[model samples]
Target: MSTGQATLPLLNTTLENCRMVIIGVDPHKDVLVAVAVDGNGRQLALRDAPARPRGYKTLLAWTAQFEQRLWAVEDVRHVAGGFVRCLLAAGESVVWVPTQMSSDYRKKVRASGKSDPIDALACARAALAEDLPAAVPDTEARNVKMLLDHREDLVGEMVRMCSRLRWHLHDIDPDFAATIPKHKLHRPKWNKSVQEFLARQAGSVAVAICVELIGRIQELAQRAAQLEREIAALVVIHVPQLLALEGCGPLSAARILAETGDVRRFTSAAAYAMHTGTAPIPASSGNTHRVRLNRGGNRRLNAAIHRIAITQKRMHEPARTYLDNRRAKGNSNTEAIRALKRHLARRVYALLKNGPDHAQADTTVQAA
Candidate 1:
């Protein structure tokens, strides 16, 4: 779903007469409903398959036999790992049509309730008509996906446990915030210390509130530690370069890698910046021309870029100069950092696209 704002002209003109195929998949908890359509938007097949082994096998069989120039499937963001992996293994040209995009088409086409077959047909028609979106390729796709999802899960669990801990804390120590950090400690290393502190405090509270808080924090810490280990392992494999960058530790690098699946998909540095929301948006209608900050694109990527920029501002001559210039122009710290984020994204994109030589050239030219 991450894409640059620089919209390239559609390249499917050469595919006008080519046979395109679409396998519309509506994945559920236990079942996946799939329907196939031909190039001319003809319904070819419809079936309900098991969400696991049998369904995946069925989809793969169809993919192998079909002559498809484009195999459009619904969003692989939240689901469709097995399906996408199957398509990729078979070397099929897969396009990921966003769920919202497909839903909008259904609303416009049918304007009524939908069945699996009908929805699949709609998806196929969209693909044949070149209304489908390009599939986003991930750089360290598999590992990044696991790390990002697991990290988020751990964070959510920590949040839940912290809420309970706060309730318990409120009952025991009214002035707890004045003594301790406002946020609950999440690291596993701090788990025993926090538990012991809670245990000691609860002995004095007479309500046993600290006992529950200690247990919850310990559980949360263990989960967070597991997530950290998984993310570190993933970074060692997929995003080693990202980790090498200043301020882009394992966790941050993993987040960036997950957000930007494949930097090669972007045509240029500007395009990559635009997709990350670090590229500014030009507000020129007729004559009034100015580039305002863009608000769209992947927010997580934008955050990562900003963090990199902030890190670079220290000990880097050019980055420091840029930040000073922005500040002298009356821009706040946030605004200056955002501008730096844009520049940093472009640099990162160039590094990914043309390697160190071209990136150095770009930096030299910018400096001049």
Candidate 2:
């Protein structure tokens, strides 16, 4: 799952009043090994099923023996999309188990060995030991997230292809790089003469490479643009308020909403910031007391926040004043950026939670 780290707290508060059956699954490309356990942690059944619609149906029937069954899935969004989607559509209660937690549980159970069945059992035990949050896979958010990721990949391919063309042009004709505008070089409209010249270099490998890379880049660019339009349309409908923020564009708004399915799940702005990796971590000792930038949490969401902070620092008057004040107080550039990101995180949280009417920023800077 593309989520912030899911930690099993030390308190170990589990479902006590109601008895619930946990069906833990270790999914793979072709098969899924699953184990069902009682609320008290006793294994009920273990089964190996094919990873298909028919197998999913059979698995449901098998688990039906239990009156109330909750599916505990590992990395539901990424590694087990097919099954997770099917389960969510079927309206089954699902809980996500992080890979680290599952592995740690497995080591405690069987210190010397590892296998699908063992992992499945460990997942069930972990679920039984903690109050895991339920997973709600929203159809709209999932579609938008996939499109955003696909567009990013397409953009990366375009950059690689352009870099290859630039390097080849530099090596073949050093003067070509200086004369041709970098931005114009990737277009089909590049002077017809240059194309003819590259085509004439038949004996050289660079000629073939350049021609192939250009074709791929053009195709990728077209697809990326199409995905961007789709993502923007979805964001406008689902999260128009986010777009109203000073620096959040359609893509940025979509990413934040997609990563965080429901704003209500976070109890407060601090929780939201921590989930986004913008919250500072304590780095203090006997002689000094201070906070440092968190290096963990949702990296993609962190990147979106960084982009917004950079945009606001460029043009937003309030953001500039805040940065200037922080700098004047002796904060370094990196620390100032972190503080700004934290502010944006809290701002986004309030906006998402309070609706569009609360879109305006306070313009009151916080202490550095």
Candidate 3:
């Protein structure tokens, strides 16, 4: 392929600099494995540096050594936040490649491919070869991402504990949840108030078991609520506009911001949709095909967009009306929601991509 043909303008300056370094990171307990490689994808050095203080220092030193114009690292979603922060703090330009992409490359090239060193080398090669798109580095958004990641971790823990608690309660008392309505399982008030009744049961074994299970579940639920409140507070502090959307609550808004990073990186709404996996695939092959969903992009982003679509179907006028119209025209529920999601993603992309007159444009569209 020609160098300038498929190349985006974003690659111009970096390619000119040519002294690129790709750092493959395997973040362990106290240390992270960092393999630094030159632009030609040759390994330069390896380090077992501290995850927090020492790792960052090593990274800074390495950055100074290369004087590299561009840096690339594997994108590990929530896990790579700290590493990315360290790189950004040093004012280094960073790009992100998904682990799967790098792993597949390694497997294809090298027959034996299951070590940290090899993986690190693969990461370097991926960056040098343009195997993945360069990510928009956003330090401010990283702070927001930290909060979302913390909240997600707490929520996941709470969910697991809740499930275990339910099982323990069921084993002790078969009809424990029978007193409350089935749909109220997710409600904290129901869990809290009903626990008193369980605790007051005549049998001691049932009472003891119920007390233990309820106590654990209650604690988990409380923790989950605290995380929720913290997330809301952070959104209010940093990402206020995201919460302004009709169906976007604090959590969802934070998630969208965290996932998309710098929205301006997307050249157009279509680009944004394609990155988020909301864009329909081009399926024409000499007039032999229809469009289908592209599975090439971020799954989490797609899920987030799907959630936004579902939320808007109930709360936002345009979304709801559009879905209704689609369904009335004989589209299935899934199809209608997908159509709504594509439109919603475009709207979100527009709001983020456009400058100064976003509100006015949104209002004009609303009126029309």
Best by TM-score: 2
Per-residue lDDT of model 1, residues 198-272, tens digit only: 655525653365556556667766776777887788777654655545556677777777776666555567757
Q: Write the per-residue lDDT of candidate 2 for residues 1-368, one digit (tens) a residue.
A: 33785422222227563467889999887888899988787888899899888889888888878887788877645658889878878878777666666777788774369999888888888878755545665657787888888889888878777777878878888886567677655566664445776876756787777777677777887788888998999887777788878888998998998877666656568867866889898888996756787865567889999999999889887888889888897777787889999998988888787765654545344554
TM-score ranking, high to low: 2, 3, 1
Candidate with better TM-score, 2 vs 3: 2
Give Cα distance to truth, residue 229, candidate 1, Å.
5.4
- Name model 3 segments beyond 4 Å from true: 1-69, 77-82, 129-140, 172-176, 186-189, 264-271, 279-286, 291-298, 314-317, 320-340, 353-368
Least accurate 10 contiguous residues by lDDT in model 1: 359-368
Q: State the weakest 10-residue window (summed lDDT) of model 2.
A: 5-14
Q: TM-score for candidate 3, please give it.
A: 0.73
C-alpha lDDT of candidate 1 relative to the true structure: 0.64
What Cα-based lDDT does every candidate model obtain?
Answer: 0.64, 0.77, 0.65
lDDT, model 1, position 116:
62
